[model samples]
Target: MIPDPSAPAPTVRRKPLLAVLLAPLFMALIAVSVINVALTAIGEGLGADSSGLQWVLSGYALAFGVLLVPAGRIGDATGRRRMLIIGIGIFTLGSLLSGLAPNVEVLNISRILQGVGSGLLNPQSVGLIQQHFRGQARARAFAALATTVAVATAVGPVIGGLLIQLLGPELGWRWMFLMNVPIGIAAIIGAFKLIPDDRVRTRTRPDLDPVGAGLLTLAILGIMLPFLERGASVLVWLSLPAGLIVLGLWWAWEQRYKRAGRPPMVDTAIFSQQAFRNGIVIISVYFLGATSIWIIVPLFLQMHLGHTALEASLMGLPSSIAAAFSSQLGGRHVLRLGRKMVIVGFGIAFVGLLCTTILAGFVDAGWVAFWWLAVPLTLMGLSQGLTISPNQTLTLNSVDPRFGGVAGGILQLGQRTGAAVGTAMIPGIIFSLTEGGHSWLEAFTIAMVIIMALTLVAMGVAFADRARETSAPGAL
Candidate 1:
């Protein structure tokens, strides 16, 4: 067979593309985790109470979650490159505001701005990878992303702790935000040059469906508000039902718009795709189970067990390292093994969780128990690397690249929602159990079981999806 000389060469340069895309992501993730270690300094510096400190975290989360789907829709309709640059710019400005904040209120508002910026760019990154990369390259790209997530999650505390120790509390926390300024500027410049502006223009204008967007905004705010403001007001629970109602209305409007031959904010039909649907289930459930470990473990080690903040962070570093390594390996293999990789990942994670629970339950609380916990935590991290990137690859494979931004947005929204619910419920369970006279280990054991149960649910979904693919031969 003769190769066609006229065919255009593959223009996608994987490494440069990934670097440009992942830089903003690294900055965003670090902001999320690093703030935990700096909360005390921030409160003291700003004269904030527990409630104000909570807002600094919650405001970021809320703004981040709310903007995801809308930003994705806009990016899909417009040019992703443009959106990515704008998002990074906004994030940089927010970081500047946060670093120089004179009051808790200003700091909380700046954090929300940062969240909005992160929310805007995240889907564009995923979409660009989907649009440019194919086959194994796509898997590797996602793996790289998973590695960034692992490294950022693991090192955030260490970086925060080191800064605070060397520079003292007042200036250290300020530097955490300020550090992103140069990085964000560089990323924005790279994004302008490296990110291809390849959005295909059509004669028919794309409809953004503002009405649908409005409904979704209401629904998301309603559903997420209760979780964010957990103890604020009993009236906050009303938002849950209100959110549900708005969600139903949004569904109806989307269906109606699609029937009328207009583009809805989200095409209701995407949910019908088995791969996309099941992938969302697995990722969301996995996040629900896995993300809480970073929260509860630190609390158990530092607040209850009286370890130094940096010491507690170091205990989790091994797991993060394992995750960072395995994610790249998992990316290489995901194309061959498919959903089996995720199933195996879940199985290993369950075992790790079981081991963690048993060890914590049996071993007395001290450095010894902490050391034992590291072994299982590393296993869990390895499992995570296998699960996350592979699941993302499998899920988005079915969607057309044109809708990649919207699809990625929706997928991340599910993940964020799951994390919110899980973090709220799982941590609350430990606190509630301990307050009710349960030992710290006992509380941790119960929470671990819940996490295991969530992981099992995700595994079950993966198995069912695998069986469906086998039975139908091309259903996925």
Candidate 2:
């Protein structure tokens, strides 16, 4: 039988292809923050504490961070689209398991599985964008992607709140995970039909660095476990030293592996580019401020102001909307304005956060408080929108395409690691400061100071980037 030459190749128009490719990853971003409002309900339902709550959130982040480098490598070795499908499927399964989990331990385990899935898929999403799009198309796609992320981050809390309110505690929390089912299915279908397969040249089977993976995983776990178990003095003490030792060893092993011409968990050479190194630090600090806002703001609304979860989620709308719009705008100006966007972004975010800190002290059920919080949150969102996409583009652009996967993975690791640290530490800061004091206002002020201080540090990094850019071979 002759092969049918007339058969149509799968017709994926550019627009649909963008949607098909971006939607699942966008949903994944939504999943990251959706659980924030649900934490209390999840804890109550699963018989958890503050520590367990931290585990539920940080476990996914830590797992995702640890596995990102390897997962990116796998996508490169195999196929980006193929691995993405598999990863999304795994993530869907993990989400279901998490929703149905009978206890805190099971929920934490499920979250880790979800993180693994995120680890596998997250890098592929960015890789596909790099592979498939270029120039203006790439810029537009990134803007859209950023908007999706902003929307997801903004809407997740409200959706979770609604689900919790409508369905009540028992069934409501499950919907958070269950909600992924339809979205995941659509993404899978879209992948098979719409996403074009992009594979890299391979000469031999890529060697999996199991030892390095193990060490990295353990190191992250050690570092995160202490923060998760904030109230447990013994666990915190043990994890701190142990995490440091493992990290030191991992660094040593990576250096040795590089010398031996083996694939290190993270290629140290990327650090050679001043822009890439500084970009990663900036990304880290940006996430620290952003994630801390997400964590602390909701807690303040729910606990101090006695707002419902729904109300808290609603309070986040202004910021989310602003971020969605600003990300695209930032992309446009990146080429013209250069890296100064980073400084501009942080400066705006600093002012916003400072305003929020002040407003938080005087919060009440009125438009005054709402506007006060809304304005800053909106500016913060705008700042993030402006800073994040450009910083990511700059980081990846500065590196070789061959090592794009690893570099992207490292950037994402920095982001999630910062998030894990921020979420874990902020609560402890609030708790410690409020131990003997009944003034929630006092506690919030102190926390805001710490957060603002971090933002200032990030701003300094951005300024350093501009200085470095000026001194380099390229000139205005």
Angstrom error of the Cα, residue 101, model 1: value is: 0.5
What is the TM-score of candidate 1? 0.96
Query: How many residue pairs clash in model 2?
Result: 0
Give the lowest summed-lDDT range of ten residues in model 2: 1-10
Give me the runs in candidate 1 sitting further than 4 Å from their true place.
1-10, 199-205, 362-369, 473-476
lDDT for each residue of candidate 2 in 247-266, tens digit (9 for 90 to 100): 88988888888899887766
Q: How does model 1 fare in lDDT?
A: 0.88
TM-score of each: 0.96, 0.90
Q: lDDT at 293 for candidate 1?
A: 87
Q: Which candidate is the best by TM-score?
A: 1
lDDT of 1 by residue, 58-151 (tens): 9999999988888888888877888899899999999999999999999999999999999999999988888778889889999999999999
Clashing pairs in 1: none
Q: In order, how many clashes per candidate? A: 0, 0
